[model samples]
Target: MNTSQEQAEQLFAQSSSEMQADHFDTAEALLVKALNMDPRLAEAHANLAWLLDRRGSVSEAVRHYELAIELQPDNARIHLNFGATLAELKFFHAAEAAYHKALLVDPTLPGTWCNLGALLAQNGRDDEAETMLGKALALDPAHVAAHFNLACLLLRKGRFEEGWHHLEFRDWYHPAEERLRCRRWKGQSLQDRVVLVMCEAGFGDMIQFCRYVAVLRAQGAAQVDVLSHPDLKPLLQTLDGVGDVFAMDDDTSASDWDYWVPVMSLPLYSGTRLDAIPAVIPYLQAPADRLVYWRQKIDQLSPRPGLRVGLVWHGNPAFENDAQRSLPSVQTLAPLWRVPGVQFFSLQKGNGEREVKRFQATQPMTDLAPDLKGFADTAAAIEQLDLVISVDTAVAHLAAALGKPCWLLLPAFMTDWRWLEERTDSPWYPQVMRLWRQPTGNDWAPVVAQVQAALQAWAQPVKPAN
Candidate 1:
């Protein structure tokens, strides 16, 4: 090899070592230097693209991927990475073409097939997705992501039997979840034993599954301790049958617990069925002082003699499915503003908070988000509201956990499995919660319109006694 080629190869090797160590900045710098030295280094370009895509620079990654594929057109790995970046950017057609090309180049790539399957699933092509993911598992039986994706698809279709079984692959990907010193509780008798239920996934997931703690105790667990997110500590403490609650990051390896169980896994072992869900409402409660303060605050404002409604337009932006599940802005909810007598309070925080100011002049909605420190705070505020209208956020779960009247505005495509399809009410919290699903498209207008109509009827003045 020539001197320049040798030097470029050395730089690429160094970049690979840096990447393995997760020193992304150093890896990126080395890849850039290697590419500058030899622009035709397709592997370096592909690796750089992968790094950029992982770091969320999808457009830049796409450019690099295109260049890499141009240099080495038959590389299936390049095509797979390119397709993933395209999918992240929501270029569905381009992504599909890229995945097809990858399959044509190398049909045996299990990861590529899994990626294609997931993409099809996200686009609502479920039958095709199932076939594609089945092909992935046929090729490599232990493909964790394929199993997880298949499980999600099955659960969404309400095929709970197979779904719960496949959902076990989740622990394979998140090994930290299974790094317990104690044995896994597989619904074994806990007559004289303590059980540690570790919280997993998002705030909404924790809230949804925490109800099982009481069930565990009822099933004869002597003591049930929970390891959960720090933010949920205050609220989780109020739950019945809970012996102790520890934060997720707190050291618990030294703690004495006879067995460990993931909060989400409780359903499978406990034989939780759709018909037999522990629908015990109000499993969570807020501090008395906090609830009183919010009640007094609402009384002091004294808006009108109508329903007090809380609104959340967005969820965590960092969530993988946030693009499909979250509303673009509070402006999309404009129709709700015209419902006379009903006072709207903004419970949204972070990215969409500025939109409240934009609409405050015209809509006259109160912003309560600034004072909401945690789920406990949100729970207290929700206690004072007559109803909560939310966009698939953690606060929605908080409202439902508090057994407050909640109306969830859900996106039509790729909705959460917990909501299930073709259903308006959640079995998890029935009677108090109603679902408003977006039509099978990207538009939120229909959802907002339906909510507006419902609010209009709900806000109708009561007929006075003659």
Candidate 2:
């Protein structure tokens, strides 16, 4: 008869194989059986936690991680896993302590160094993050997360040359889209060549980087086609120098294009520098008919409103970083309601649209989201607004592309790479944007107060500053 320890080891080996084959359900069952046989099996608990985390049972995973750490106090890997779970839960300081402890237990672990470095970078500790990431790279030269983290740190510091170079390693983290089979564009001659530029990331990223379509044309590309989300097709068609906007689901052959490039790579290939950003205003246009329709709708709804201000309080909740990037709710935006004579239009979409009704009784705002079909409709509605005040979302990008004034609300931590660091103005939208940053630990009161003051000033009649 096999001893309990020997039987548990066999079960664990079988579970490892199941997990490697992507049979998560079987793997989980086996892990549970193994843990029952050997209650003190720390590795079994750790493996189960990883599977649970992947399956979105984060709270359960955290419990398992805690149990694993308790069973094996000196296991550096378990500590590292515990740190990752804590970070995911937004327990930043505790996560840092866990990472530090893991490093102390095993100074040679490159991954621990990389995770600690990335955590530091997210919290805005640049110098120490650089040192930690550098140490990770020294230990394992090909560590992708270390390279990506270092790239972001450099970019934040305005070291574009080195940053872009390091950014090329992002493919290791997320490989470039493989559907398009064509030669990749590398800033060489585009004369008489047809280049397909793909929108590889989020909606905001697409809007921000699609300006490069016009830049590609200026570089003598004969035809510039775009493969992007279907929702953007209507609006992208209006962008300058774009020819034949294709939906991402299109089964078109790449044989038609001489080369292709990911949209995110455009800034790097365009040789963009901080001082020389392609800051041309009004690169996108709303449909004339839609613009007229929205204008009429707003006029009939609020016949003699003083200032029409559009507000977006939340972004897509499914986004991984939504905890840091998104706001609590429209309820937190009460300060904006206090600014008299300013008519608030709810430009918020998704599940958050219901939030408007919650405030409508007391706040008295117009909800424009129900009639808005897609980005084209949103763009048209934005054109009619006096100003757009939004949390970081596609609407802000839409306002920027339309060359309309926008007040962009940013979180104190994990603001996007495009926003860079510190200054109020954005290089991408220079003349048409203002930024309001949240304080650390998810505080939005200060940012809302700033916006309230600015809105009051904007609503007033023209007066020269002394």
Which numbered prediction scores highest in TM-score against the true structure? 1
lDDT of 2 by residue, 1-466 (tens): 4599899999999999999999999999999999999978999999999999988899999999889999998999999988988888779999999999998889888888998888888888888999999999999988888888898888877888778767767662134466666788888899999999988768998998899999999999999999888999889999888898989777776448988888878888999887878878899999777888988888887777489889898888887677667778888888888888888899989958998887678775889999999998999999888899998998999998899999999988788777888879898898899888876768998988988898988787787989
Query: Cα lDDT of all candidates, in order?
Result: 0.88, 0.87
lDDT per residue (tens digit) for residues 1-466 in model 1 = 7888889999999999999999999999999999988999999999999999888788888899999999999999999989989988889999999999999999999999899999999889999999999999999998999999998999888887778877877763256656677888887899979998888888888999999999999989999999888999989999898988998678776789999888888888888776788989999999776898888888777555778999998889898878878898888888888888888898888889999887778886898888888777889989988999998888988999899999998887789887888899998898989999988888998888888999999899779999
Estimated TM-score per prediction?
0.95, 0.93
Name the TM-score of candidate 1: 0.95
Model 2 poorest ten-residue lDDT run:
172-181
Can you tell me which runs of candidate 1 are displaced by over 4 Å?
172-180, 249-254, 464-466
- Which pairs of residues collide in model 2? none
